[model samples]
Each structure stands twice: as C-alpha cells, then as structure tokens.
Target: MQTPPDRRSFLKTTTAAAAGAALTSTIARSANAAGSDEIRFVLVGCGGRGTGAAAQIFNTKGNVKLVAVADAFAANAERALKSLSRGENESKVDVPPEQVFAGLDAYKAAIDVDADLVIIATPPGYKPQQFEYAVNKGRHIFMEKPVATDAAGVRRVLASVEESKKKELMVAIGLQRRHEPTYMETIARIHDGAIGDVISQQVYWNGGGIWYRNRTADQTEMAFQTNNWYHFNWVCGDQICEQHIHNLDVGCWVKGMYPVECNGMGGREQRMGGDASKSQIFDHTFCEYTFPDGTKMFSQGRHLAGGWNHVGEHVQGTKGTANPGGWIKGEKDWEFSGKKVNGHQQEQHDLIEALMRGEIYNEGEYGAHSTFTAILGREACYSGKVVKWDELLETGTELAPGIDDFTIDSEVPVSARPDENGLYPVPVPGKHNPFA
Candidate 1:
C-alpha cells in the first residue's frame, strides 16, 4: 500500500524548488486556454464544510467540477460525494467510488488526481502539512480556517504563503468574513478613519455547545479520537482556534495587525465530569489581547447554553464604534443597508475570479497570523501566563506529534483515559505549562 510522502521530503522539495513564479504563470495560461477554461477540483477532508466548499466552487462562474474526494474515513467520503451528487450543482459532482479515497494518506491520492485546484477542509492540525504538499505540487488551493492549530503549524503555513506567492498559486483561506460585502464595506470605512483612531475592540463566538462523537467499543483509541477530533486539543486546537478564530480574525483585521501579546483564562466547566476521552477540552475562554500601539481587544468564546450568544466583532475608536457586520454608532452612526451575499459562497466566487484573472490571491500569511493569534490566546489560557507573539511563534511545540504518520492502529497522541470517577483531566491554570 502506498503511504503519504514523508514530511522531510515534502519540506525539502518545497524549499528547494523555486519555480513558484513560473509554475503559477504556466497554470494560469493552462487554466485560461481558449475555449478550455474548465476548473477541476479535488476535495480533501470530506466533511460538511469540505463538501459545501466543493458545491460552492461549482456555483462560481466557471466550468468547475469535483473530480475527486478524500477523507480520513471511507464512510465520510461516500456521504460527502452523495451529498454533493444530490445538491443543486449535482452536474459538477463526478467522483466515482474509485476516485474517493479514505485513510490517513487519502489526501495524497486526491491531490494526485488531474485537477486544477484542491480544497483542504480538514481539521486545522492537518492543514499545514497538507497545504505544504499541495503547494509543492504547484496546485491552486482553497483551504478552510483557522489555517493551523499551533505556532509550529503557523510557521509552516507562513513559509508556504511566501512560496505560493513566488509560484503565484491562488490560495484562499476560509476566513469567509473577509469576502462578506457588509464586512468589507464597513472595514474599508474603518480603515478610512470612519471609526477614527481605534481605541478598543471586542470579538466573540460565545454560543451553544457542539455535538459529541460517541466512541464505539469496536474502534481503536486512535479511531475514537480522530472521530471525536473536536474534543482533542492536539487535533482541534481547542474551541478558541476551531470556532473563535472567525471573531479573532475580524479583531485583527480591524486593528490592521496581529496582537502583540495575550493573557486569558479558561476552564472546562459545563462539559465536564464525563468520560475522560469524551470531554477533555474547555468549553469557554476569555482573553485580553494587546496590540503594538497599546490597543486592547477583549475576546470571549464559550459553548455553554443560554448564557449569551454574541458572535461578531466590535471596534471602538476615538470618534465612533464600528461593527464589522456592517454598522457603526456614535459620531458616524450608520447601518449596512446593502444587499448581503452568503460570505461562505462569496469566498469561493472571489477565489475563482482571481484564478480567471491570473491574479494570485494568497491569504496564507494573513491566515497564519490570525491562526497564531488564536494560538496565543489558547496558550495564555492553558498556561495561565501572558504569551508574547514572538515567543509563541518560536516555540517548538508540535500539537499532535506524529500526525503525519497516522494509521488506523496508531496511538492517540493525547492519552485521556478516564479516572475512577470517569472524569478527564482538564487544563488547570498554573498547574502545568501548556506551551511546553
């Protein structure tokens, strides 16, 4: 059986090859060839988001089709294919059973197909590695965010961003809010001083809890954890990175820079006292981020039910306060009264448009920075210490070590065996070093 390419080779080849510029130009010409401008795509990580992205790509203005599908499980890939085949853009779904791949190495099989683009919607932990491989192969990509789950992964993504630019690959991150017309218009005005000198900001994703994947007795530890990845810190990067990144990205966007430092607190309160394997991650986090100019941004993310459900970004400036969702109050009181497009679908539309125009819209760098911002908040909450931007970026912490070599029988990187009371060990602030 064939295995995924080793990480060393992937990194070495990507670093050694300096043909990004030329390869990008070649891809542009090939994609835009007269009367043959068909954009073929392979969907990696056949989850709801992945399949949705495939369908959205077909919705774009082009002859786009889903040529292949890949997932960690065969069942998931089949479900995704079936879902796409029955969608409004069913004509674009062309992945035969043989073309649908499953297993840890399934992404390589999908990427190997003759396709113009690849959509990576896997768990954030797997993104950096998969993204590097796709870039090395000179493929245009549409990857979901948060782009990575850790500082180490962020480093790899940042490097890929530069390489993609050199090769001119059109890479778009799943920070879909960036494509929302309301947000775009509002932020444009904020940048134009409609919000005056930004003084403070607040971002949130506090909402109800997420679903839990019950572990089957027949499954291995690895299978169980991978199935319930969102609960695992190594795989999901915790709730802060997984879901709250959307709000955090908006905060950074409003400030026009990443945070300089972060300090926060979090704990697994509501979803606790369960089987160790089932409830390991926290359900709530509150972070205070400081930008370079001493600007402060208060961020809060929680999954507890019926407390408060605010999921937007608000920036307060010297003159006015602006909501990135298309509203402003105080000196420049205005509300977004324009038409709204589905930002989720708009992200794909913009990406395909850039491809057709031969323009490289690589969001890799910004994606990494935003992802790391979440990591900083997580590390702060986990370690009970203030984490500086530079130090966290330089940490050798590798969440989900040996993820590149995962197999059905592989051991789970985090061992969350239940205690006598069937409870898991949650992060205790000031008890252990999370960054270590």
Candidate 2:
C-alpha cells in the first residue's frame, strides 16, 4: 500500500515539538513531566505483528529502542531478532541474547527489565494475564486486540484499564481503524449527525481461513495446541473474536457503546476429515446485535474458500448512509480524500505521541468492550441463544484452563475428543452450550 500524501505530510510535519505547540496547558504540563529522553521498550510476542509493531515504534519521532523480547517459543524469538537486526530497524535493536527469553513464563522476565513500554502481542488467550502483569509493573503498554478470548479475560483487562489510569500509564490497543485519519474524520461526522440518526449498520470480515500449523512428531499435546492456538476456542475465540472483531468494533464505535444483546448462530462448514483432534473452532458465524438505542447491527463472518468476500462496514441512517471508512451519502454527502498513513503505523505514532506529551491515553476499556462485543456475538452463535452483555460478563468461564501454570506436558483445556470414526465436537445450535 502506498502512503497517502496527507499522511506523509502529517508524519513529516507533526514532530513532537510541532504537536506540542497546540497542546492544552494540562497536556503541556504532562509533556514537561515526561520522565526520560530515551524510551526503552520490550515485546512479549515475537511474531510477525510484534516485529511490525517494533518497527513502527522505531519509526516514531523520539529516542526509542527495542530492548528485550519474549515468546512462548524460542524459534519465534530467534526469527524476530534476525529480522529486526537486518532491516531498517536494525539500529533500534539493543536486546542482548540474555534479554531474549523463551517459554510460557518468558514475558515476566522480559517485563522485569528496565523498560518504559511493553508490547503485549501474544495470542489472545494470554493477553489479559500478560497485560495485567504489565500494568502492575507500572510499564506503559501497546497491546493487541481482541485482548482476550472470553468475558472473564475481558473483565481482567477492564480492571487493568482503570489501574492504568490511576497509574497514569499510556496504553494503546491495536484497533488500528480508530487511529486512522479517515476513520476518525468520518466517524466524527456521523456522530455530529452528518448522516442523521443511524438506523442500521452492517459489518463483515468474510474471507478465507487462516494458516494451520502441522504438529510435529516431537511436539507434545500442549505444545501442538499452543502452536496451533487459532483452531481452539480456548485460545482464538473462534473466527468472530479473532478476525471479525475489527469490523464489530467499528459497529460499536459508531454506536458509542457495546451492544445490549445479541442473538446469533454459527457452524463449521468447511473444516472436516483428517486429524479431528486439531481444532475446536467454527469457520462461520452470523449475528444480529441490538444496541441500547434499538439500532440493529447485522454481522457475518466466514472462512470458506470460493465464497464472496467482503471486508468493510456500511452504516444506514434516516437521512443518508455512510461507509465510515470512506464517504457518506444522502443529506450529508462527504468523502474522506485525506492522505493515508498505514493504520498500523499511525496507532504507534499516536501512542508514542501521547507518551511524549505526558497526556493520559488509555484504550483498555474500549478494547475490552469491543473484545466483549465480539465475545457476545460468539457466545450467541456458540450456544444458539440470545446473550446479554451483563450476564455474559458474569459467567466467569475461563478459556485455556490452568494456563497460568501450564508446562509442556500439561493437559489442554479442551481435549480433541472425537466420536466414532473421527470428528471433533462442534457447536450445534440448541445442542451445544458454550457457557454451560
């Protein structure tokens, strides 16, 4: 993707000093209170996204360094280090071999280093626990989203958000759309009634399935499960929570709150045969979420190949309709012709800026809410029942059971139990109850 001219201008012209010129008195004071001229950061997950985030942080307009890295597997950390040390971000790598740790408990050792910021980019199952630990250590954070696989994890993240505020730690969540200039401008107009009252909304992330890791002979059950976490409900939270959450989040942002209730249905249409023990997740989910104002959001996600793929949001209002990421039609017709910076990079830009300005920036609550929103839709689909926000959060169902104390030989939360010939248990509308 080419960088938009406007985005280039913003990145080129908006230096910390330039941005500070228009800061409020409070923000200016906060900026002056910034603790250090050099900021050291650590990464908890050394996957592709983590490496990309580190590159973005290095691109930020201030003194920054990638000091340490941790991962569930040593191979991933080694890959990230090699990649980071060879490219344009090579100068930013200061992590000694001793600073790079591996294993399930590696994050704690990395977080204990003298660092100002920590990037929690691990799988969703470990996000809440890792994020909570980062907050407790008083380190600023840039965490990936859907922050958790279930509501129990969402509560922990929400609590961490409050604690972050009290500690004045800058926390940025990877809902990259919210950081995009076009999304910000368009959503602001919608909120200002540019498209009148939003009557209905549609969001989607219908596309092909993600990569599947083949289990090796030496890999233990827990190792294989952790390596292939995407196929397990205890880790990835199904397709809805893992990938479709981005679109669902846009719906919630447009509504200014999470949905009140959701009734949905989903199933595994394409996944079949072979090693049935490898997966326990659905490939498709359809949900109808009702916001507090009675507005309805229809959402659908599928992973089947050779199907129509649509990955965007459409909002229909009384006066007109709008594609919040693009343009509006009807009475308030407008288009976002702005220069585009990469949403991924822009999120890091905003976070670094907030930290530099000493202004309080916390996306924990919003991230958790959007994550819960995804979970609500999944729960509805999973159990084939209407799921309410309040009740869902109180279910206290923890995915990845005993994850906090798991060794390579530990039993997985959900066994790959097959019936008869070979077929893992799948959600069957009225037959399966995820919450129960």
Q: Which stretches of candidate 2 lie over 4 Å from their true place?
A: 1-36, 272-275, 415-423
TM-score per prediction, in order, is 0.90, 0.90
* lDDT (Cα, 0-100) at 54 in candidate 1: 84
- Report the C-alpha lDDT of model 2 over 227-259, residue by residue, as the tens digit: 887887777888898889999988877766567
For candidate 2, the per-residue lDDT at 220 reads 81
Q: Give one digit per residue, the lDDT tens place, for model 1 in 1-436.
A: 0111232432332221211221234344354424567788899998889988888887889778888999989999999888888857788877787899999788998998888799999988789889999988888888999888777788888888788877778778888887887887787688778868999999999998898888788998777777887887777888999999999988887777667788999887677444354777888899999887788999999998878898988889998888889898767588998999998988888778667756555667667877888988998998788888887788736767777898878876653544667555567888747556
- Give candidate 1's total backbone clashes: 3
**Which residue pairs show backbone clashes in model 2?**
none
The TM-score measured for candidate 1 stands at 0.90
